[model samples]
Target: MNVHLGKTPVGLDGIAAAETVLSHVDGQQGELIIAGARVADLAAASGFEGVTARLWSAATTRSISEAEVRASLGLARQRAFARLPELLAATSGLTIVDGFRAGIAALRPEAGLDDEAAIVGACPVIAGALVQRARGSEPVAPDPDTSHAADTLRMVRGDTPDRGEVAALDTYLVTVSDHGMNASTFAARVVASTQADLFAAITAGYCALTGPLHGGAPEPVLEMLNAIGTRDNIRPWVDAALARGERLMGFGHRIYRVRDPRADVLKSAIERLAGGGADLPFASEVEAYIRTALRQKNPDRVLDTNVEFFTAILLDALRIPRQAFTPIFAVARAAGWTAHAREQQRTGRLIRPSSAYIGPRP
Candidate 1:
């Protein structure tokens, strides 16, 4: 079947590859809607479990209550924890996120295992374990009674997190739970279109996320902030980077022509984090400087703040290390990945696109 290819958009930009009921990204307006709810409304009203339930219900045509979702995910965490020895062995000598990918890949592909719950549940456990292992501590088991965000914090940090900390993390998770057909989500859907199982689909999502063009920007955003070190250094640092033709890590996004709504949501969460600390104020100042400088420099380009800017701030404030940012993103985004996988599976069509043969004719 030789499908005629028109002028292919670079990087599949402005291309509608597949239909999704999961989420919508309106780039021109900088809006993100998940299921039937706006991102800001959903992030404010729900935690990771509620959002996950909503997404799952939308994807699978199953009506799952938030309570049921939370309970299932809690049990799933325990189930995932049972495979710790194998997970650790598989992840040996890899970077933290790579460890997470390896650990996820190691999950037993059993028909009886609830794939959605297992993938979502296993991600946090693997992520927390990697953090604990890096800190020279044994991995903590998930407390099945705790919320997913709270348990993740408790497991990773080895202590009870206060209400504010949990709330902040919950907001971060909900905010990033899903965005439109992003690179990783698209990758997951592509794999799913092949009738792959949930685990394999999400594993592909993690692989796509490891690429710097996708979910890998948060750590570099942190590095940029650290290099600047103070609000005063923002202009010179950004000028030097722009002058060298280097992309500003968090100031732009391919989908968001305006300020990313997720950025605004996370920034608000940072504000609500009891006692807006020195870091919040410093970040605000740096953000202001960068926005002003970038507009002046480009004048015609819409290089506004994206999610990574405040993601770095919020995660750093939560005391999550820079290296763990992408993994943590995967932890939240796994819900979306699996939901999209299920959606694509329902379509029962392989997403096989034809590439225009621009090379010499054979």
Candidate 2:
């Protein structure tokens, strides 16, 4: 017996494509819950590795441990470093995002390191390599003794990061761990539904992420702010952009009618970082002015602040170049993609949605 609901709204809006215990995004109330905890509390409390374990536990039958996840990831990082020279040689001269994707695509199943650990652990290393390449510096090797987020910062900067810097990046990673069945997550599920390997599903998600509508917003956030230059230029530039019908990048989200909950989580992370300089304060003012201007321009439409706005600021505060924003995002989001793939595979059902035929009368 086959069942047909027969309602395929454009973009699958208001659709529950899959059953997931991993994370839920309540756009109306602006709430994000991950693995039975609210996103804010989870990010504040758990390290990214712990969050990865939690998400994995929710999807898999086994009770995965934080220590196990951490240990596996540490070894995976070492292996990734071992493979780096070869990967870079094969992928020379590609842009940061492209090179990062190429490197991940080159991953083959290994004897001891599972694809799960390989995908998650390789993200920071790959993204950091791109940053180093852009700066004309040699890629820094991974340090297994340090925590994942700390090592990520260390690699990006080629220097050991202190506790606070590590904490900020961890919070950023934990906050973006999952958000319902997003485009990338859905794409991952589709790939996994066919019983594909973890690497394939994650690579599918990564491909979806590279799309301009999704992963492209955050880096451009810094670019827009740089173009605005100073606090004084915020209002005028916003007004002109709105007049010229240009979007204020990072301000809007397709899913969230209210402000993105991740933005608040990240904005708070920014407050905890060391540099309380003019940038955050100025960005705060810009955020306020843009919110008001956007509201005034279209009173009915709610295009509230999204994660990308604060993400750009937070990454900038950590001194990461704009070019590596999406790659870093892929690193964090790989946690979610892994779990979603597992969850989809458990159902043993393929994602086969039908399109309504609207052309050519018989």
Which candidate wins on TM-score? 1
Q: What does candidate 2's lDDT look like per residue over 14-106, in tens digits? A: 878888899988888999999999998998789999999999899986798999999988888888888888767666888888888788887
Candidate lDDT scores, in order, read 0.87, 0.86
Name the lDDT of candidate 1.
0.87
Q: Write the per-residue lDDT of candidate 1 for residues 1-362, one digit (tens) a residue.
A: 34446688778888888888889999899999999999999988999999999999999999989998888888888887888888779787888978988888887653445789888988889898999999999989999999999998888778888898899999999999999899999999999999978888999999999999898888887787789897778778878877898877788888889999999899988888866342887778778887987888889989999999899888888888778888899989999999999999997589987767765554
Pairs clashing within candidate 1: none
Error of 1 at 320 (Å): 0.9
Best by lDDT: 1
